[model samples]
Target: MAYKALYRTYRPKDFNEVAGQEHITKTFRNALKSGKIAHAYLFSGPRGTGKTSIAKIIAKAVNCLKAPTDNPCNNCDVCRGIDDNTISDVIEIDAASNNSVDQVREIRDKVKYLPGVTKYKVYIIDEVHMLSQGAFNALLKTLEEPPKHVIFILATTEPHKIPATIHSRCQRFDFRGISIPEMTKRLDKIIDEEKIQIDSEAIKVIAESAEGGMRDAISLLDQVVSYSEEAVSIEDVHAIKGTVSNEKILVIAKSIAENDTVKSISLLDELIMDGKEPQRLVDNMIAFYRNMLMFKNVNTDDFEQLIYKNEEFQKLALNLSNNLVFYYIEVLNKALHDMRFTTNAKLYMELAIIKMIDKIEKQEIVFEDTLNDLRSEISSLRSEIKTINTQKPLENVVKNKEDVPESKVDTFSKKIINDSETEEPVVNEHLIKAKEVIVSTLYSKDDIEEEVPNTVEVENKILSSDLTEDNNVKSEEKDIFNTSLQEEKKVDNIVKYKTFDIRFVEDVLNNGDRELKIDMIKKWYDLDRFATVDDKPYTKMITEGRIVAANSKLIIIEYESAAVCNRLMKKDFKEKMKSLINKFYNSNLDYLALPKSVWEEKSQEFIKKWRNGDKDIKLTPIKNSELIEIEEIDDEIEDMTPDSVKEAINIFGSDNVKVKRGEN
Candidate 1:
């Protein structure tokens, strides 16, 4: 009459009243009706999953005033007394506290006694796994050969801890966690009977938060009812659980789609500061994206089926690419998994959001590249048309042995080289010969020496010093050679990193030893030892990559993502990995990390050439003192027309000049 929690007040008195556990209930009911009750029974499952409640019901059903009944009629005096805990025949024990051998021995000694007010004396032991080994041994004999009038019900969350000797003697029943729909139905019934006004969505939130435990669901429902002034809303559930609303999750998704890193992170910080759980936030975001993806693929007008149905959500589903949504789910799922091992959950979520933003930026870059490709194609077409117009008159002039200007010959030669088609048209032999002569004349060694005197001086000094062993060189020239060597040394001393290098892959393949790769792979299991420290991020990154090729002096690792490859390519990461591997494998071996896509392209090329009987493969080793870092650059050829050629083309005029090839 004072105050009882929903779980205690609504405890099922009959076997039929329990939800989501019809299998165990039906079995016990049929057994009780047929008088086939076991002398000792063991029930094991998760907490708050009706293990103890069902144990009590079994005791009452067996001892009810009216025998031969499948369930206890609470109207009877015997059932009422058992329910009120005033009966002497039923004994309930918390084995967690009374887990000594003496306690179990006392139970064994009392099994011969008759029931005082019921048909059978029942002993209910909770958390039976907590009993000591000696206690289990003491109870084993009694359980194996219990008196006809005695009944024992043992309940435990962890059944593995119970000894096999005891387990073999009892009837074991494993209870499963309540399903979501079943839990929601039970919670709905409680809310209806209690006359509590709450939104249907709020009940679902509570059920989900309970995670398949009936008692937990009821407890959360009771708490929410008490906290709300009137009808409980979904917001109230979110507030109680420290999770964000569906609308907030939508906003975060939009921010990510827009590549707004600052906004996404700011919103995340606010939620974390407001006592919202980072793990729950990531989960909700993942669900949001998942629903959006479903909406795109599934033909459903009922917005109720999805978690979010607002206009903003619809727009996002319409606007966001399917690929981006998939990536979002992947990143959030990884963050959710990683958050369990770290106390700083917020950091991981923030990093995940940043990664999504970067993905969006990369997508935009791809789109821009596609547009540039279209423009390049159009320009190439126009140049082809101009070539057709100019080549006609040039062919006629060549047939007549007309004296063409040197500029005109250069223009014609450039067009012939720039043509995309493989076949060359008929042209005057003299014009081709003159073009070759002019190239030799323009780029003579004397001209190069005048342009870059330091380079020529260094080359001359190096040859003279090498031939004479420094005896024929002047003191001034010797100083120049030393300066050159010092400069080269400086360049070689700078350390660098690259996102991907074909040379690295090639070097490993040329010297790859399958036996060495297998040996190193067997030793990769030792990597787990480095995982305990926080400073070894590269170790974790290394685990993400696979050892595709290996040799005594070099190794090639392939990763699924370029982002990971880029991270592993940092100067500090390289040094740490090199030192770690050297110490770990007891070898001074260099390693390369390449994205799977790049590796596939390059390795396939190598295989094709190797299959064609090309055995001249070579290794391009990275200097230990310097590994040059190259930024990702567009590989398309750049314009490199010589000044003289450009001047000649201008004199010939824009219309007369058709297509002209740029020097490499």
Candidate 2:
């Protein structure tokens, strides 16, 4: 006799044999006995949760040699034939492969016939939601009003796709995923029966790796059994799955906490050398950090109730500071997000780990930032990298300065002034030699200029050049200037300012347009601040960045860690940040990849503000459809001339203005 896989050999034969879905099982078993069955039964649930198995159980119980037992007797001729697919009455179809109106019409044609050996004919359609609209429409009426001899059992992982017309006709029985404990217990039984020597930690890993899918767990169990016939351990399973070990994850976390980039990166390399997948490393480490965090703060009365089953890790969580653990978890989570779109998973993970190390080290001497802060900082660091990447070096300084103004202090005018009398730029000893171009360009023309003795005369000539523009030119400029001034005067006196509230954390990460976490943070904090040109707001931080842990009232503006960064900004910053963030949800925000408890330590400021009815107003949640993008703010502030300031005050009000009030 040939060997059968554990999942196949131990497949549930009766409704009672199926695990973790008693609701659906009990409903179906009673339906079989009561003779109140619907013509079409829609079974929906997550994968590996037993929708298909229950369908088979119903098929056998109804067509059993004996008229009515909730449980089928496997030895009976009808049961054995159907179980082996030898019975013509029980037809199990894979709708995924045969999903067409034509295929459904064939079924519609066949329902008129009677059962051959069994009492009733049954059609089991697996992945029924995969069917096209036409296919579903074809089977609608018969599904609602099929003959007494025919039964249709439709199963799918996603029920939302099934047409409402088709869904209304069927009796819906939803199958739920088996819980971790129930899955673990079932796996333990298989291990005992198969005589496979494995430890408890190893069993737990298989269950978690299955992600609530029983079929997946059993299948993995079968594979693990084949990997090593010797005494099996959790470490062996880790090696097989390319998963990182708890010890390695701890070392990396400690390095991050210590701010040791070199050591953290070295450990990352070692894991890669061990054939570990960067994706898996990031995933396992995230779980490890999450569990450690839960252990530190929450009372998970049964520590075993949480995911990881390693005692060493549980013990390690006890010794670590609450802040450090969350920081590393946040770092690894960013790494995992990067892994999804990147083909070079190892490269991205390594880069993410390195970024985290840098942030941790940067914040080492810093204070107050806890584990949550560390996570936020890691995100900022990634944003900074993107900013550096996108900046362009200037090439032609002489050409760029062709548009310079002429005056005592370089003022713009109606005419282009070539007056060269800008008081030599008041160069200081600390400053390097002035060139033709300095601030924006790589080179400057100031280095080649000849000195003049009568500077006041030069200034007068330049002013004359600007003021003496042709009458036609001056007239046009005067009209335009007055209109702008009028608009500014109207804007500066307004009282109310707009603010936005992020209803939930999920909205915070999803920008409708582009994947931009960092830029969103910077813009939210202050409209005056520009995201680093490389990729400030979104790419570097949230898309695949790290958050930092810092100490102080100042959020120490960085590229990543928008969550905390936004919180640290002024109340106005929070509103502005929320508004900017509203654009980031679709890959128009998708690429933009990018929380916490303070044991509720309240501030008196919030109370005072609340009394004034400031805090009582509900926050305006973002709309689902406004577009977002990883874009540079195109405001005129960067080129903030005197006129720009006057306009800003008019539009935003005096309260929104932050000028360097000079003391003359």
Candidate 3:
């Protein structure tokens, strides 16, 4: 071959050659040594973690002529043939392309026979998730109960996509991505063997960028080394990879922290203009801030710090507040990730820049507010100090005076225990001193230690009084309800009518509501309130969007016309809206109040009201009236005590009747 990719050239040939998958490697070795191998095995994890390579190793180990060890002696013809795919016994199947029921049936038929020349027939299926439902079903029984001499090794990146029925039958081993340090060590050894000149920084950059994929890092290193005979520098690596420079990232963060709007915008434009994806640009900025936060609070002495390899980047992190950095990191991380799914990407990018400007603007918080915040922090600190100072029992001993005579207090009797046991004096000196401190600190010398009355009974009395007040309120409501019911009965006898109120309006607000509704309907009908002179409403407070939130005191409605809003404040539209709402929701008792203008935008009008003279008239339109004919109404009535009694029975039905069998 003219040339081979470094990753393929250095493909792991033995268990020892594989990097950073000890969990997978150890299991394979044990399986080989124990000879208790399953007929079908599944290896699943992130891509390039050696799942495919391990499957190949298994194929070779089982078919090796001279050995049963985990490591295959590749010098033998069997191992050589397996590597070359010339061995009749071993078959490597790319499941992704051949995942069909027919293909699976063919394989199932073949696994029934013994190996041609080798000890066992091995079948390796890669990316097995692509197998159809029917294909997996076909493979299920054969895979579960394969011939003793046949081995099935299925590998997939997303094991979750594979049918659970087939997955349950196979011996599953999850391969993991290689750790960075492990990948780095292996890359360094290969660089040495290839005699490639590269700096440690370049190697580190490639390793971290690989994101735990060893083969990826190797491939990256090979690409970087192809064009350079000199040792690679961070700058060179950054140029080739089109990665954000750590210094530039720091400058952007600093500008954001300093509230330098001009610089922040300039930097963003430069990045976007220079081919950085707006989303990726946001991502890098987020990572920059996250690193600053990690450095700000954590003891990095114990951590393997990877992001800011440059000393200058570390200094920038040092200058930023950890809390502020953390806040920015969290917001931008979410924003950057969300930006991918957004339709207006430029708008989202503008939003991210605006956020950075906001952070910078907030850096200089008010001193008084910060002082109040520090009080909480100080309390937390004192609590920590208290916890650390005395883990011993009995922390509180005395508070008043410095000394006490134990002889005068001999009536008190107790013995204290300590983890440190020692002989006590006839009277403990410490207790005497502590007692003296308590007397002076807590009480006056002449103050009597009387048997004071407890306040529990007094509290109970107040509580009972409050409860009685609640009872009175409830009773008042009951009385009102009863009175209302009696009034309702009278109203029922005297008239057929509807009851509603229109209120909670100052005269000014009522005037505003009247004007607002007229203006709204004008817009709804596209008519001019003053005159039909324009396409738009005169009061541009035309309906735009719903009122997102409202309350008893105020209702804030959205409008297309900012000018209308400005005029409303000058003319008190809020008061108007409030009165209108009260009138519609609780109708003005006189029925003179107008219905509220600010109904939920999506809700159809439930009630409509119009002002009649000085009194408002509310109309609840009957959509479909079902009027009863007089004869039909009479037929439903029963025989009664007279025309009046019969009418009452007919009106109230059997419910108002106390009639015995023949009383009527």
Q: In candidate 1, where is summed lDDT lowest over 10 consecutive residues?
A: 420-429
Per-candidate TM vs. native? 0.55, 0.56, 0.58
Q: Could you tell me the C-alpha RMSD of candidate 2 in Å?
A: 25.9
- Give the per-residue lDDT digits (tens) of candidate 3, residues 1-664: 5898998888888899899889878888888888767888999988888988888888888888865787888889888888787888888888879989999999999888888879999898998998999999999889888889999999998888998898789899887888777888899889889988888877877876787788788888888887666887766766667777667877787777676878887887887788777776777677667667666667664224455456767777765555556667666776777777987665677676676566222322222234456577656544543342254212221111122123222112122122002423222334333444433333333321321111122322323333423556545655676687799889867863221111222222222332334333344322223223442333234233333222234333444443444444432443453344344344331112122232221112211112122223322332212211111123356645677667778888968776556666
The Cα RMSD in angstroms, rounded to one decimal, for candidate 1 relative to the true structure is 22.3
- Return the lDDT, model 1, position 533: 81
> By TM-score, highest first, what's the ranking?
3, 2, 1
- The Cα local distance difference test for each model comes to 0.75, 0.62, 0.61
Q: How many clashing residue pairs are found in candidate 2?
A: 59
Between 2 and 3, whose lDDT is larger? 2
Ranking of models by lDDT = 1, 2, 3
lDDT of the structure predicted as candidate 2: 0.62
Best of the two (1, 3) by lDDT = 1
